[model samples]
Target: MAKLTDMEELASKIIDKNVQSYMREALTCYMTGAYRATIVLSYIALFDDILAKLDVLAKVNKKAKKIYDEVSKKRGNQEVFESDLINQLSSNNLLTSLDSTFLDILRQLRNKAAHPSGHKPSAEEARFIYFESINRFLSKEILSTTQLADEILASTVNKNLFPSTDITTIAKVVRKELENIHPDTYPYLISKLIEKVPSSDGIVSKNTSFFITGLTFDNNDERIVSVVRRMLIEKKSQDEDYFTMIIRSITSNPIVLETVDDVTFKRLKVIIQERISEVDSTLEHSRFSHPVSMFSSMCGVLNDEVISNNFETEFSSAIEKFLYSSYLLNNLSKSEYAKEKYIEILMSKAGSSDFEVANKFARTCYTIIDELDVILTDQNAFKLIVNLLRAASWNAFGAKDLRNAKFQSMPAIRDKARALDLNDKSEAKKIYKEVFGTDTDYENLMGKYVR
Candidate 1:
């Protein structure tokens, strides 16, 4: 519907000079009653715009550049033909379904007009080619590739431009363009996007979640870990979903735990310890779901041997403090398996030859005193006494004092074990004999306590 004057205004805005010239010639042919010429020339202008855009975008996209190179080679430095551009754009998602259909219609019209097999279009059809197809579709699509890149960047950084648009759609377009044109910006863009999540949760649209996850999947390494660290530190509140998302992504990712450096690992350990401590502080008032869930997820990272090895001392200290302070013993009383695991970790540390480690483990053992009725199995009671003895062997007290202390504690252990009926009296005798070896004083201690 645009007149020659209006068409010229549209033509002047095209960034590609060649495309502008072709557009003008096509418009001129249509106005001068040259219907067939207008159709052919309009198609030329549209095809040139597509090729020029593809060429600029391809500078950053290896795949797109590869296709462009092939098209150039086969066409011998001539412009890429309309059919080739349409097919490639359709496959690449640059053109939507309706866009492809319109392009197909133009291609068929161009073929009919150019090849000259008795298909002469009327003036009205020529008007449609020049004003509707060229002006509305092709020319409107022809922003300089740099302009296209800038527009995408603006949509991403400026929230108001595409207010209703899905952030993930914008991210997808940016990724596709970068995969072809600006591959180097992936890290920068990803970091910037992550920054958006904390300052304004709205910026991280639901659609954008997949984009964030996809970045981790493709680059699951130290850089991703660093991003997670910063995000966790920035998020001081107990946002369980945020914590859950990061922990699950990082844990399931292959290189995250393996490749994290010592400094970063230590930072992560401190953060998790702080979270667990927070939960411990509130154990009596709350039922321990939220922080417990967070801590449980973090245990996945701690379970890694390399991380665990580096964090042994700190880890032991946290477990000791948490168990000693919290009512976790009562909470875990119903879980036979958890009771076993807790005892194993505690007694293992208690068995250490190092006095400090043994003593720390011993203090943790004291917290379970009241819960011992249901918690101590026959096997654990044996292990518990063995651990206590091992710890006593490392006692800072002299060996003479250590001997006397062990002599004294054995009766109390026997009485407690027997009071609980933890082991058969014969089995208790067997263990006592193995350790005491027929000493008359030991035999008296055992005889007085065994019954």
Candidate 2:
């Protein structure tokens, strides 16, 4: 329990605190790089339902879906790609309140990513993917539709883009085209564009004030409830007019300091580190009209502040201050369940094909084991087993089954994986039988293991 003095901070911290485990996993996976695609793909396919519920925004909306169908039909046609897609949306009855002009812009990027040799999204794109996917697919109605709109629009403003010298630049071109949607979101879109762009002109000023204003706010509304969406599967480019509008809009409604509850405060702390200079400190901790259960998160992902000044220079001190705050994180880590859960998430991600992120996580876990007690406890030992199993065959199973899978016997699972080194199915099986009862195995591992 939190003491009275720290109640406010604790309240805000709750929101940010819940996901450190997942974030830890993501970070480790990021370092390995081998399991990134698998992790991302599996996450989407597996947790499709959870994501759908939580998602405050849908990816295709009605407009994008219309275009999607048309594009699918004209497999080889390039001349009228946009028209084909638009027609398909009109025909499919997927059309809704969202704008088609924006869908036109989105389709191009989606097509590029889906194309055989087209570019994959960069880290920024990936982050945005996580954000929008969560909003469209998994997020609950934390705010009303009106408030939801406001949060998204307001957040987008902070994610502004600066002027580019090159008018013909692909990213800039993309932005100009997307203005039909919110027009204000262009700056953050530009931020995402730069994140996806390969060594192109950088987006300066991060999630600062340069923003597009006047977009309506979305309070949690029931209109889009229980709807599954895949909002952003690709990243768009930047444009001059869109960029200017975003910058102008945000400057007009500069991000003010937010008076956050504990739940939101931790989130602010985590996000603020990206690029401190651009952070509207006053704005980050402010209170909003949304409910805790259904509020939209990941709004800060595209904040121009992150893309502006170096986060190292901008947010390091603030992060440090938060970490040292009277045994806050220390207490959390000391809890065996929490520590083990964190490790399980991290290690699971580490046991992937992406060697860089995987290895990075493994090393981090090693350090934790050597350094932290809770992470290495008897309870955690079993927890590690469950995590290992989850990691060893993440892509092989349905994500929906994860929640139901028994984990009480993780200790045995861990020992089995290690005894066979996750390489010899026979040895692992033999060990499994010994520990789990039944099953005699010396050969034909998969066949026996399946039994």
Candidate 3:
């Protein structure tokens, strides 16, 4: 048996003053050899502490008070037993499963001492009750939801305080609390979880981030989904599996995806694509929104093999549309480096046996010259026009008059082309004559610009 003074010391630590006093009485009884009286007092003190916990829970859970009221109303003239209080708290979910089981054990011991069972507990059993009730239940205060949330935050805020096992325990606790649909504090808990994303250690932050995916919120109630979006944007994930986990979580959940607004979804899409693109630099460019620049970069940066596979596998039918996309083509024509890719794409199509696509590529290149200083200085641009002009079978200018836009822009093209510091001026001059030929258009061009 524990010493009498040791039992007194345990009683002194009880957080509730009333519970402490009752437990102190129980210790005094045990030290004086009143073992049955000691057991009764210990159970009374434990019961008082449980009542105090129920009172606190009542403030947040209206149902908590109802459970106690029902039990109290039924137990008229009878002292409320530990088993009754335990059942009410357990049924109402005011206590955890483990806690319910522990309380049941304490309740059975209390029954033996309260009702004169033929077998009375020895002084050792009475001492065990006194120590456990004072230290485990009464002395240790049960934290409110807000206090528990604060503890979780403190654990994750830095390395010195963060205990990995503690964090795991907190995660399960928070998840369970949320699962219980504790509306009064759920939003605050979610906010604390998300607030860790940018600042916490990556492993802890990622594990906390998983809380959103594990939750089930309403379609209209986007609080959890919004936090997830913020985590994806703000958290710099180092682990590929972590990144993949988050991406799959968001995309796979229909409710979450639907709840995310367009702007946020677009931003998330950009972040996800950027992460995926880390494997292939070519995939980093915008595929749909800025096709011209994307394709141009792909042409210049990625080798033929990568370009071929990506275009075949990823781009699919988009390849044809991207090649012929006017918005992208216009954007391409304005870029110095992109114009070369533009010319290459057009040349490739222009050389195809498909006459219609070939002719369209030629005419589009001619029309792109209307954009002042757009692509005219590029040798690839010059070569494309030369190849098109020399291929009479394509009949690129069949319906267009010499007085059309292409002819009208000849003087400007000539000036830009002539001023270019080409590595081979002779090749440049030959390219210049093939398209801006020495025909009547050139004599008229020389007359107009010779001054």
Candidate 4:
């Protein structure tokens, strides 16, 4: 909206070399006091920029192709060609009505300036035409190619195109293609991709997710964040799978969390809590893994203080409940990668200074300490033993019975502990004696001590 002060400034905004040439000539004409010539040349530059954009869009868009074909046929007749192009652009939703109106005014000025008329545009009119032309059309990258979104959707099903299972690489390809699209087109593209989520098969669904997540890379545009937030709110209750996909996409790029409003964020917290609570160990691995992954990813986002603290307590409570849930403990023995991953997750929390969470985690581990080989080995096993003793020492009142039950149930746990190197073995024996008020019987460590 700022007024154009210098011709060089106006020319610098233009990207196309052809448009720059026209603007450069217009600047020269304006400097020589040729106001009418400036207005005419600037209009030419604006029209050429529009045509070039339409030509690019025509390759993939029927609307733009039709407009380009119609305008191409009318090229010889300047009056009809310009009028048809502007009216078509406006009607097709490419150019808003206001932009069309501004272009019309510039066209009128150009007509008057080009003709043998007494009317002469002043310097103000010339500069206005120059500035509006660049600001409205030339400098803007308005592809409006919604068809590109369709093509991308189709490409998602093609294995050759998305040959890599790596979501990052696939997302990079998606992001590269999306860079040519106007920001206004993103909402439509995003909605289309989300619409595909609930119904698509695994590969298609995953690729679609990668496509949506790809949009957040290197993009902090509020327009995109607003659209995604609105879609999330709309889809939260309407469709569970759709809601999950959108939320995962947002959390996939945690930076987006920085701009999310508190109300929306609270809703996300509730959804995540519900999902984690819904995790059923009785079901498939994905059922357990999906919610836990969501929980961990959302926790990662909370590291940034920009997110509201109002929901932190609620989220922490959810994390505690999830960490200590009977379902998670049951899942630890399931011979799947999710179990090991969740164990690592538990160990991470247990190793922290949070006594309550660590205690709950340690207590839950009591249910499955005999199944340690299913979840932990080597360093992880040693860490679990160390944490168990640490937690028991912190709350030794009733832990004595529970610890006795665990070691009694799984005497092999002592042999596993004794298998550690001299240093770790010495540390374990030290913590064990401090917690149980007895020395580890190195001669018969696996023997059940009923004290």
Candidate 5:
């Protein structure tokens, strides 16, 4: 039932160009009513492709290497070489029993077509051979082994091969190598990469994270989600450290949270909650700062439902407490970055459809602005105040009234607003008018408040 055009299109998917050339010739023969030549040429292409895959497998697998070596010695004898290759592949578990049987049938058809037999093949028989050969052998990559997976993972560490800081570029490099790997190898490859997450520190850590994130988010592979869920479940009880590290990494790529099942998501929520609870603002240097910042970053991306149910109170309180404490504010660069993340989290939360959620965030921002005003002696704190105000004013959620009230009540904030350059003041007035539907006369309110 297969048409010559369909057969040629399938042949084009063959990764091996040499095999493609042979299949092209076979299709040409099939079109010309040369049925015997079509069968012989298609079989030759399939066999050659299998041999090419064997060579690649041999480089990474010892069993494949042994089989390849034996096949190489018998290459002078065509019949013996073909028979030995199939037997060795079957014996080594490289080819399934069904696959071996299929190859054997194709080989027999090739034999019949090559010899001067009284029997002549029909068009259907030749088309069947062409389609079977291309689909079963020529189009698929070799079965991927653990060693091959490791080889691919190892190659990712080479800077020359993966030299991009951009995650999209790095993911492309990873995908190019992984696309050739058989699908059966994905679970093992994923497990190995997960194991690497806790220990890998530099570029290796980044590549591993981006690759896993790409699989889950970019490719939308359900198998990846299932594997990660199963692995996390196993690691949760068996290896807490491994489980925690993976959770931390997943928080960095929070879109992954959207893919997990509810139970797994709830577990992740509890773990993140436990981690955030350990943050001690009193300490001169809390080791938990990183996790807190990560959680804040995650909150900035998650939807209102997840934020309200899992993180609303805890995250808001944590950011407020951290901002109020001197520990973060004392470190200029770190404090600026943390403030930026905190403001982003608040901005996202302030957009919530739930009035209580959005209103609560406005109150948090109001209090944070008060704290920033107390610390306004620090030039960095002053800049953060302006940034937070500018960011908050842009969100048209239920918080606008609360923000306007706070702005009117705070004299120091009024003085700071009065000191703003023309562009920033104009930008602020524009956004405020856009958000609150009113233009505030900053010049009129200047003398009424004491700095």
Candidate 6:
């Protein structure tokens, strides 16, 4: 055991030193394959060195009794380390599929890197793994530390999507917004936004990314960068119309707002409606120059051949505008449905063929369903989802034939629809069974209203 302990300690130090050397020599002005190979080998050496020492501790290598006494049994607390990482991630309480994938990949590699003789990864392979792992680990931390971007996104009610932007302002927004997320979604959403804004390219683009909103730092430190990023968001929010309203009740979010009551979210509805009124006033403004950015751009006539009944034009007029506008989305959609769509195009576009690289779309749908259910009970939202499912169903077939993607089966669309159905059905069953004895086909009753 003592021999093992000594081995691990020495190995950790060597790994740490080698990593620094590798980074400094391999990257930037010193970029070369030798440096890169050295970096990669350093990572492999970390694991290899540790395992080699442990092997000595084994009966095979001969564990010395006195040496074992000198070594302590407790290494760094694995639970504590993992918990801290998880806590930082969930601090803002939003996780998109991309964020989830980034975490999944990082943790998996970490395990591979830590285990004994874990398949003798090559130097180049080690570098590749390290390359990817570094981003996975740091992306959220970098963004959250930036903090300006989250402020901008959450403050979407007043500002244009790409308002005359700057890195300082972006960092400011991210810092401020982190306090608003419930910590659970923080890591996932933070990862998603940062990954989109390639930090590897340079500091300039990285700084710019924090401004785009939906981004944040992944740590608890309230450093100067964090504070400044927060300051920028608060300042920007203050400049916009209805700033006072959003500022007044930001702590009212259902997903863990500190020092606020649950009822505050209900009051937020009124604030949201007021913001909707504010957006109505901006329609004639000159800034909405992009053709697709217009509030009505994403909206379409719902050719619901099955509905047979016309959607109330009276209601549709107000609702239709709400569906497409980014400003109205956070409020009107009730769930993250609209917000997710906006992110989709922000990251990728139709005919662009750059599918979301980091997140599984289906998993994203599931998460939205889970989070939205906490606050929303609208039947209309469910119907809209059903319509979306239909679209996915049709597109799946076309995609299968055209691109030969394996996920083109009807099952994919059905899975999406079924996620909604299961939630709706379960909710219905509980309510109905509680009210009346037994249940008589719950999905049927719920679908009548939601479908």
Local error of candidate 6 at residue 191 (angstroms):
19
Best model number under lDDT: 4
Compared to the true structure, candidate 1 yields what TM-score? Answer: 0.34
- For residues 133-152, what per-residue lDDT tens digits would candidate 3 score against the true structure? 76657876652234444445
Q: Name the lDDT of candidate 2.
A: 0.33
State the lDDT of candidate 6 residue by residue for 1-451, as single tens digits. Answer: 1222332332333323544343434233113434334334443433333223332333221222222222222223322233233333334322334544555554455555455644443444445444433333221222122233344333433434334444245445555554434343444444444333333444433333433332322222333223323333222333333232232222111111222233443443343344445554445321222211222222221122211122123123334333233333333233243334443332232122323311233323342343333323333233333333323334533322322332233333334434556766665354445433455644553354333
All candidates in order of lDDT, best leading: 4, 5, 1, 3, 6, 2
Return the number of clashes found in candidate 4: 0
**Model 6 vs. true fold: TM:** 0.22
lDDT of 3: 0.52
lDDT of 5: 0.61
Tens-place lDDT digits, model 1, residues 1-451? 6666776777777656777787788777777888899888887777666667667666665556766777767667665456786677667655556667777888898888888589889887777667755544455533222333333343454444333334344445435544432332334555454544444445444324334544454343565445544544334224544543454344333344554556656655565565555654644422222333333333433444653465545445444555553345554454444445566666666566676666665544444565653556664564455445545546623222323444343444434555433446556556544543443344454344334
**How big is the positional error of residue 170 in model 6, measured in Å on the Cα after superposition?**
14
TM-score of each: 0.34, 0.20, 0.36, 0.64, 0.58, 0.22
- Counting only residues 3 or more apart in sequence or on different chains, how many pairs clash (N, Cα, C under 3 Å) in candidate 2? 88
Best by TM-score: 4
Candidate 4 local lDDT, 60-126, one digit each (tens): 6788899998898777555468877888888877776778899889888888999988897998898
Quantify all predictions' global Cα lDDT against the true fold: 0.53, 0.33, 0.52, 0.63, 0.61, 0.34
Instruction: Tell me the tens digit of each residue's lDDT in model 2 across 340-388.
Output: 3334444445344454444444434333333333334433343344343
Residue 394 of model 3 has an lDDT of 44
Task: Report the lDDT tens digits of candidate 5 across residue range 1-451.
Answer: 7776788689888878877887888888988999999998887777778878888878767888998888877775543678777887887767767778888888887778889877699999999998878777787777534556777677546556656645467567767777557776688888888766555556666556556654543444656666765665434534545544554445434555665556665665566566556655454332322445445445445564665566555656566445433334333233334445455554445455555655565566555565556545333322333433434445644345534454565556555655552336665455445433565643442233211
Residues forming the 10-long window of minimal summed lDDT in candidate 1: 285-294
Could you give the candidate ranking by TM-score, starting with the highest? 4, 5, 3, 1, 6, 2
